[model samples]
Target: MLNLLSGLIGLVTLILMIPAVLPLLGALNWILVPIALFGAFIGLMSSKKSGQYFCLIVAGFGALRLFLGGGIV
Candidate 1:
């Protein structure tokens, strides 16, 4: 349950981090990206096979946005 919670949070963070429509979201996302990654990582490590896969998707997308969303630093 906690794993799912974290994974979902990561997914939300990923959504918020997307800069395609909202520039302000992009600002907060830069700070939240690492936190989201950590949440996803924790979820991944603690989850079952299925949950792990979900977390992987969250982490992967978060990372993708982190680089492409202008949050690399």
Candidate 2:
């Protein structure tokens, strides 16, 4: 399902946010947060209840990271 895929992306993004993990993933840590946020946004915009619920959790974490980090600062 599209929702499921998006949620998975959120999970992976969380993993990638860690500096130690990002190198293992061979990705730039700076780029992953917004990708996760975009996935969460897509999930949130879905009409399905499951999508909304899962996305809320992922998005909450993503928002917290953004808040604590310099994403908005």
Candidate 3:
């Protein structure tokens, strides 16, 4: 349960970080990107099962974004 929660939180954090981090990187503030990515990696690697669930969630969101209007970003 805790692993699942961590994965969910990490997935959400990555989604939220993208838009905010991208613009800042273009504006000359790219340092946070690696940090955020590292955090995501750590979160995902914490548990194998949870990581798989996280991937499924991300893929689902990606497909939804591609076919629909709403997106994680």
Candidates 1 and 3: which is better by lDDT?
1
Q: Relative to the true structure, how large is the alpha-carbon lDDT of every model? A: 0.60, 0.58, 0.45
Local error of candidate 1 at 12, Å? 1.7
Clashes of 3: 0
Q: Against the true structure, whose TM-score is highest?
A: 1
lDDT per residue for candidate 2 within 1-73, as digits (tens), equals 7687777777776665565232233234446656766776777666654654554565566555555554532
- Model 1 alpha-carbon miss at residue 5, Å: 1.4
Instruction: Give the Cα error of residue 40 in candidate 3, in Å.
Output: 8.8
**Error in Å for residue 23 of model 2:** 13
Query: In model 2, where do residues sit more than 4 Å from their true spots?
Result: 20-29, 49-73
- The all-Cα superposition gives candidate 1 an RMSD in Å to the true structure of 3.6
lDDT of 1 at 48: 58
lDDT of 1 by residue, 1-73 (tens): 7677776766676576566225435455456656666676666666454544565565566556556666643
Better of 1 and 3 by TM-score: 1
The candidate, 2 or 3, that scores higher on lDDT is 2
